[model samples]
Target chain A: MAVIGVALVRLRDLFGVVMLSGLFTLTAASLYVVMDAVDVAFTEAAVGAGIATVLMLETLALTTGREKVTRRRSLAPFLMVVVTGAVLIYGTLDMPRYGDPGAPIHQHVAPRYIEESGREVGVPNIVTSVLASYRGYDTLGEVTVIFTATAGVLALIGRSRRTRRRKGSQTTGGDQDAR
Target chain B: MRGNIILRVASKLLIPCILLFALYVQFHGDFGPGGGFQAGVIFGSAFILYALIVNIESARRAVPAVVSRVALALGLLLYAGVGVAGMFLGGRYLNYSVLAEVPTTGQHLGITLIELGVGITVAAAMITVFYVFAGEER
Candidate 1:
């Protein structure tokens, strides 16, 4: 996957890069599905595969098609990555199995969400009940984050035609013919 | 543009079915494995298909940029509004039992509203994000 990602970066074709990114997202979503995180997998498949890929392609339309190769080989980042990988692997030695039935996660508040949530919130999908009711505030904050990101993207993209219209008719008059 | 006609026609038919299925998943989530988040993504995927099959501009016209923005805000407002309503009913924030005079089923009603809010917000936000990127110059 990493090799594919690097190859995608090196490739000049923007459409190919987008397709590669979709592949990476699919792989990640598959991993999430294997871990029983169905919701997370669904999100990765939708947002990563569907939206992000489309966005990247749109951005490609406005930019140079070819990637410029640099001669300089930066070894510092590679060294850092190796060290980080070693540390991460060492840290994972003490972690439990992927689907350990006796895991602490299954024993704690999870049971409440699974057992009591149906009676309390009256929702069969425990995840929804937890997300919308038990931890609703967090989801609200998430929505705000999305809103902020959208606003940021729009601002960065600059004012649409409406903004120029408000400024004056001078710019719009010239662009009207082009459209 | 050179793709199979069958694929195009099938996608055209499948998109609306996907959306209807998403709605079913959202509403029937209280009795199944699916819920607001999953339903939202499914719903968004349906629109994304339409955008792909028809054209981005046509999809934008169908869903409209301003309508999507309003839908996004309204979703959050719906969720928060229910919580505020709970406060007015003399309970804690999001306390659903106080929503109705009949306390037993009030929780059910509250959960439904909250789920609906989540579904709306998620679906709109997902679609809006897609639109933003789809229209981007890069």
Candidate 2:
């Protein structure tokens, strides 16, 4: 991961950067799997590695692959990153070790969810039961957020597909109404 | 992309499998480590594969942008609608016990419906975003 991060920083080509970011996502997904968060791993793999890579490639196709040079090398931003990284690392020092059962995180309602969710939610998968039934509102909000973003995307590229359909409606995919 | 016969054949073989796996993940989430969000992304990626391998035109025919747009709203509404339905059934917002005669059965039905809703929206939203981004030109 560190190697990929370093290489990503060194590479000036935007295409390489996008590919490296996909690798970075895969690395994070693998770490999630190792931590036994398979659902999270699956999401990261699908969204991060799958969709994100394709989206970035499309962006690359729209723009030049070569990154333009910055006017100056500012030490301020570098120092800021270093300080933030140091602070974050310092904060992690107080965290419990991986999979520590007695940790503060696992002491909350997780135990109750494990014990009682079967009867209440009536699902074998505790995660799904808790997520969809116990915490259904949060998921609803998330879906709304996704819908909003897609709306934004539609707004941005609304005209191009419509205009292009006039010339060769049969050949193009835009004429959905014709069928 | 359409010019490549190999790509065409390969995508044809793989797309159904990916879509089937996504359905498995969506419905089987109750018994295993899968759910709407992950299943949705996998499903969206199948269409994305079709878009990349073939022309964007055929991809649109497979799933028209208008349909994608409708799906975007439909899935979310279905989720929120379930909550509203619960309210009408005499439960508080998002309370599923009152959804049916048997509380456990109601809970089961509610989870399944909401998960289906989540899966639909996520898949539609992701695919629509991809189509817009890929089709647009600067």
lDDT of 1 by residue, A1-179 (tens): 78887888688776887889899999999988888877678778877887677667666766765576688999999899999999999998988887786888888888778888867777666776787678878877876676677667666653554664555555566555322
- Best-matching candidate per DockQ: 2
- Which residue ranges in model 1 land beyond 4 Å of their true spot? A1-12, A165-179, B1-8, B101-104, B134-138
Q: DockQ for every model, please.
A: 0.54, 0.76
For residues B1-138, what per-residue lDDT tens digits would candidate 2 score against the true structure? 668998899889999999999999999999998988989999999999998898788899999988988887888888888899999999988888999999988988888888888999999998888888877656
Report backbone clashes per prediction: 3, 0
Per-residue accuracy of model 1 over B87-111 as CA lDDT, tens digit each: 9989988877898876637777887
Residues A1-179, model 2: lDDT tens digits: 99999999999999999999999999999999998999889889999998999999998898889998897898999999999999999999999998899999899989989989988878998889889987887888888888888888777665555466664476555455322
Candidate 2 ranges with C-alpha deviation above 4 Å? A163-179
**What's the TM-score of chain A alone for every prediction?**
0.84, 0.87
- Fill in the DockQ of model 2: 0.76
lDDT score at residue A144, model 1, on the 0-100 scale: 69
In terms of docking quality, model 1 is: medium
